[model samples]
Target: MIADARRAVVRAGVAIGIGMGGFVDGILFHQILQIHNMLSARIPPDTLVGAKVNMVWDGVFHAFVWGVTALGVALLWRARGGSARVPGRMFGGALLLGWGSFNLIEGVIDHHLLALHHVVERLGPSVWDWVFLVSGVALAATGWMLTRQIDS
Candidate 1:
């Protein structure tokens, strides 16, 4: 019983970490850096006229991401019988890595080809975009590897 509780805690912590990491990324890039939000492209011209609309949408998006992540953690906890098993850890790690990869690739393609705002709009756009991509990949990989080690 105690072991089960401990495992549940660990899984929840891992989920929180991943979700918080994602939140930080969104806050830093979308808010502080003034980069494009998830749906920046869909906005009609001269609607909000500035970053206000983007900020609102970004907040909502981050909220949803956080919710989903928390739900994922709950599901994992239930599915694995509240144990930090090797498979659970690997699955969580892979999820983080996949999300990071998607962000990196999408950011690059959108900024470079689609003319969307860079990862950090204030930082000369393209350069910061690449930097963001690399950093995201690094973070995700590190999380994945560390989780794998924990599982092992």
Candidate 2:
């Protein structure tokens, strides 16, 4: 059985992962790539007005990501007492697990199910979407493996 402190740390790590993942998506994909936005599919960021509107939604998404990240920070702070006892690998694994989870669920919900946006919108549901999901699975699997490697 896992100790309460360890569990808390894991939770915190996952939260951090989620926030970081969201940031990556927002910064890399949404902003830098100019590929998609929070509502690119629905809004179709072809015009200045549409782009601006998507920008607003992106801001909202960032705000929510900030909140999740803050929660993770708070959780980590609470578990500081066990910092010495917990292994670094555990934390790292937790982060990957969280990040991959975010990608998997978000990819499925936003990219496939809702059609809110995709990894690359120009192609309109192309191989990039599958690649995103597969990457998520790979991340999550690696994380799980890392966690399993911890010495008992």
Model 2, 1-152: lDDT tens digits are 25776688888988999899999999999999889999998999999999999999999999999999999999888887645566689889989988898899899999999999989988889899999999899888887777666555
Local distance difference test, each candidate: 0.60, 0.88
Q: What's the distance in Å from true for residue 118, model 1? A: 1.1
Worst 10 residues of 1 by lDDT: 1-10
lDDT tens per residue, model 1, 67-127 = 8578757756675663455355555665665456546655667666674555644443557
Cα lDDT over the full model 2: 0.88
**Distance from true location, Cα of 3 in model 1, Å:** 18
Best by lDDT: 2
Task: TM-score for candidate 2, please give it.
Answer: 0.93
Candidates in order: C-alpha RMSD to true structure: 5.8, 1.8
Q: How badly does each model clash, as a count of residue pairs? A: 0, 0
